[model samples]
Target: MANKNAPFHPIIYVRGYAMTPGEIDETTADPFCGFNLGSTVYRAVPEKERQPRKFIFESPVIRLASDFGYQDVYEEGYDILDPEWEADPDNKVPSRAIIIFRYYDEASRLLGIGQTPNISQFADKLRLLILRVRELVCKNPANGIGEDDFRCHLVAHSMGGLVCRALLQNPAAEFRAAVKHVDKLFTYATPHNGIEMVGVNIPKWLDMNDMKNFNRDYMAEYLNIKDAFKATGRVDWLPEDSFPSERVFCMVGSNRMDYEAALGMSRTFAGHGSDGLVRIENAALHGWRRSGKNKGSAGDSCAKAFAYRAHSGFLGIVNSEEAFQNLTRFLFGDIRVDLWVDVEQIRLPKPVQDEVLAGRKVSALYQFEILASPRGKLWYLTRRTAEEDSVACLSHEEWMQAPAQRQALYLSSVFLANRARVNPRRRSLAYSMTLGVRVPDYEVDRRLWVNEHYEGGYLFRDSIILEMVPPKAEGDAWQVKYAWQGSGVSKADTAIDAKLLGDSRMEVCVPFGSSGSPGMQGQLRFIVSLWNKEAAGN
Candidate 1:
């Protein structure tokens, strides 16, 4: 009776941190916290420059209900988990639903005593909640769901992510069954490594209001990773064996200027390269790859994206179109594509070339900017730019001295669901990528080269657009087409086939600029394949 093939399991939303008793009561005041809150955003189209378009994004709750037919478990002013809760005997709640993990209720003045629990205790209660949800969905004769058929996904924001991580990575025997029932995890702007203030990690001794939950040493104890303060001295990773890293997704926020807490004191101390509170570098896990042997490698790399939204506010990451679109696709997507850059060589600038020819020691720094968007959509899937301090950096010496092989960088991953596309009639899946390699800042003999310096200049830049139609069935070839924004090629030109890797995988290589010259040059390799093909065969 399981609907595993449908891939629409229950989504448990765990909200982010609330620092005070007042904030605790605020979360308790609302039935679904802020999950039910909708946001209205304005868009200015380039074609109609002056006319701003109003895009009303109904909250995730509303969209899920209207688009996916998911219903909540609340009835007659009481949740299914409430002590006095009662509902129609034959009308059971559907398997597709959203459950709010009210971990803060026990600490709320209106709901319970005003004392917050530690992260471990919160995770423990989550285990119990998962069990209770199964009882509600599986025992009912109306839905035909069995105990074996029930599975749930965890969706958390900020510190809430840490609470879930504590459960998933918990090594204790008691939590194993609950961990098994959780199929996937998605987090938004979570400080996975622990929060840093004034360029230092938050001390465990700062134990006010259980703020020590954000401390790295304390987090290591709960996450059950020993010596997590690795050579990098950061615990921004989970043990590979704890959870299937591929099932996890992280959404990193880059805009800190919009956070207005404490009259902007939060953003000031949290500083740049942060989402007003959690730094971008600490937002994602170390090991989060969907495929490959990560047994002894550095932590796995989860599928993640970057957004310009701040930590929490009207412009926060949780309630935005970009976040929602990503959430829907990842939860029920058909195809998965990962983009990586293999730098064959980086040609130096005219001036830098002259210095290198003179056999002088020249040093430089290269930064890469990546932004991706789905076709016919105003919002992007991921955003990383120098302006947001979220771009990738490479040292000239490392690329030169390191192995000549081309496995240097990864941009991001984007998923596609024909079911979630703009036009149902159109069969092609398309997205555009804006990738740029900045001009290196030359340091001749470790000294700054200010003479020929210009700000915001790039050695190479282009928008790569890809349009593809999935294989009609398994073992069939894929029809892929691509065009470059500045290359004078159009989508109407022709379609290129992806290079088929054995086992139903495909790859498309898009090369840019000239190689081994006095300009930047490299290849963007796209690995494409069926995602959860068992669930959605299309």
Candidate 2:
């Protein structure tokens, strides 16, 4: 019988890039190649007076084994790969096996001739690996799985993600059947659009040591998506026809300071708007032009989450609780909530409001910071800060225009109902979302301008807790309870009569206000939709 609590397929881990010879040697020496790396960290208390408490994360590999009864597909210190092993019908691999792609071993001096092949070759090897996995796991009648029922999840980090995409999008015609065996793709800090060093994309001419693999031009040629690139930006590597985008998830890192790679030189060159190495803009698979025109087709944007993590090292994105939670939930969770914000109106300070109304050429820039956390968790599932990560920036002129121009800004996707954490008594999923509205600075007539002093660098900041209970009856809709922070002790504690727009869509208007600060008011209309899991192409 299949384990209903665990993921229904095997997991293949593809590690990220190894830039230097030493890095390559280190990766080849490790059996798991950093996939089993663990860390001990601390969380900063909101109050400065309190000391941060320690937290231990026993790695994703350990968690999978301990929490879901998954086992590593290894025997006698070797991974099981040969088809001959199937001769012993009793020697069958389980469905919940973790397999590591040791692609770098062939390039390491310790293992091979130290001649690294190009990514395309690695992709071809991936195709063969999937076929090998299917043969070992599916052909065994003892496993109680049919050949067509066999599938695998590809979880890759950095360049490994590109490798997975290369297999899915640009595979040889003869190896096309390999793509069908991939159930889903999850990437951690992969440069889906190719990495940028400084302000320029890695130059195609800098092919030394195969660094050109990250060049956009080279990527366009190899990934076979030349038409997706415009003069300014490029579309995602995975095309909709090859693999449904919703089945892919991109976990983006935003913290650049903590990455200690190259003695901190990597962060210096990668610069701002990056996770030490990969820029936030290149971390996601969604396509966009310089003019902000989304070239990706409807429903082609993959699910993504942003965390305050570096590209690699001690504070790596893959080694974070935020990333781990997102990974497991996306793979096994039953409920998925895609959250977006709709600004009905943005009110400026009285003085600035008057100046703008008088047509005094007043210009303002606003930054929106968003963070989400599960009900009992102190840390956030996703975090986007104004100073560190990419934030929604709007100008005064843009704010005054119709809401249609602003449209809706997608924040993040949160998955709930993981079998490991489901509470039968609660029968609901609860989360808290924090939004901060900040005006860093303004300009008047192309000159420097200042605004009224505000605490926390934000004009408005509030946290809203939402509880969603699944409907009990067939026609009954989901029950939603929402209340802003501080509403618990005030009269604002009231359940909203949220209309179920569809089977998976709901809208709620959250009141925004600044306590003790008059003339500041607005409402954030949140459009929440549950993703169609079946159609998600997993």
Candidate 3:
């Protein structure tokens, strides 16, 4: 029975790392202790500093897309409640997480019992926290909450992201099934890769239970490490397949703070490009290699924000507006963005040449090697099947490695520098020179070419192996021969001559021009044709 009247589920935001008692305390702090500890905490902060409290655009449509409101209890001190919670009194937004604690003593007594530490232990507690939120929604009744109609989105910061990853990637099928209802997940500086800060010389007595040690060396493959740490229980470091990549999205920060010693000189430090504690790399999904200003050409790429923020301080990552906006976008809107372009319609800059042309120029001619493969043979066969009968003869070894199509042709671009020009008109100019390209069989039309130029001539032998010959020798020469074209005079190679401008460089009026043919004009593409030919003796 589908509940057509069921409203959208509320967003459940999760915060990370409240390992300290003073940090998690929302009550009055010691006034005469010299410093206000509450003012310095990272996780517990104001509204504007937490989520995107302000928007660039003011219109309703734009506001909905970019709307970010601060919604945490301990972090905000109950001053500003969620607008969704107040407006309808129906749709409620809650923040929660499972608090897994490490057992330190023989009785495995819970640390900070009744305190924040005790409350935060057990990942199951985080689940319960979320469930408690759902119960609140159900109590309102006006929120359209039903037993089977509740769903929620998760937005976590730092260690909160790690807990989310563990829940989603946990290998236990039962655990996954419990929260399989979760829809969207957004993390900021979660350190999905691994946390390196634990190695810092923090007081051992501070966390005698030592959960940091477990995270440093064995978060990815946690099962083995956990088993070793325990005497006989089900020792698994990361829950079996706990946090699968697809279940979550992340926004990582990179803080640009000075190298200061406020936290202690010996504290294990994070990367220079970190949001104070979580390195940008670790904060994101591992193996999302694409970074920097450029985005991917496809729709379904990863979300990464490398911003500047301190590790763990008052004005750190949690206090940044940019981090909040990116997080909101990834969670509420479609994560995937698309980009389209026609590769064949793109053009390259013209090749650069500086030296004045002479009837003869000094240059060297050289040859190159060809690598054949089984896949290569298939490439040749598919493209040139009509001419297969004529060029079909190849050795078993060559056939094994040759491309199926005759497109394994190799090509090279020639760049010249400092060529002295001797003009009968006046003294030679000291201008730098960048000249032409030399290819095998100026009349040939193929994608891949092995440089095989003999004495600056345009001729190819019957051998399947074609090698490129160099244009110049070791020593510099005065005379130069710049006239050379790709392809032959046969009907099969007519387009080759029309496109060849003698000098491949001269073919480009623009920069980086290859061949000037209409086929190679917009799309500077070349297919390498491969043939498996028997060796002379074989």
Q: Tell me, what's the RMSD of every candidate?
A: 3.2, 4.0, 23.0
Better of 1 and 3 by lDDT: 1
lDDT winner between 1 and 2, please give it.
1
lDDT of 1 by residue, 92-201 (tens): 55778889999999999998988888899999999998988888877766557677767888999999999999999887777887888888899999999899887788
lDDT: worst 10-residue window of model 2? 287-296
Question: What is the Cα-based TM-score of model 2?
Answer: 0.88
Misplaced by over 4 Å in model 3 are: 1-8, 24-121, 197-214, 221-247, 256-268, 286-302, 338-538
Error of 3 at 38 (Å): 14
Candidate 2 segments exceeding 4 Å error:
1-7, 43-53, 82-90, 235-237, 287-300, 357-360, 400-406, 418-422, 451-456, 489-493, 498-538
TM-score preference between candidates 1 and 3, better one: 1
Which sequence of candidate numbers ranks them by TM-score, best first? 1, 2, 3
Q: Compared with the true structure, what per-residue lDDT tens digits does model 2 show for residues 1-538? A: 3322235578999999988788899999998999898767633422324553567778889988987778887765557764455445556678888989999988999987898889989999899888888878775555666666677899999999989988988646756788887888999999988887777888889967788888888888777677666443563556666677778899998878778888988888899889899989888885322223454433446888888778986667887788998998888776777776655556666676577788878677767788888866867788888767567666677756674453456777888763534466777777788888787766778876666655457777778887777666557777777777755532124577666677666776666766543223556665555543443343
lDDT of each: 0.81, 0.75, 0.33
C-alpha TM-score for every candidate: 0.93, 0.88, 0.42
Q: Compared to the true structure, candidate 1 yields what TM-score?
A: 0.93
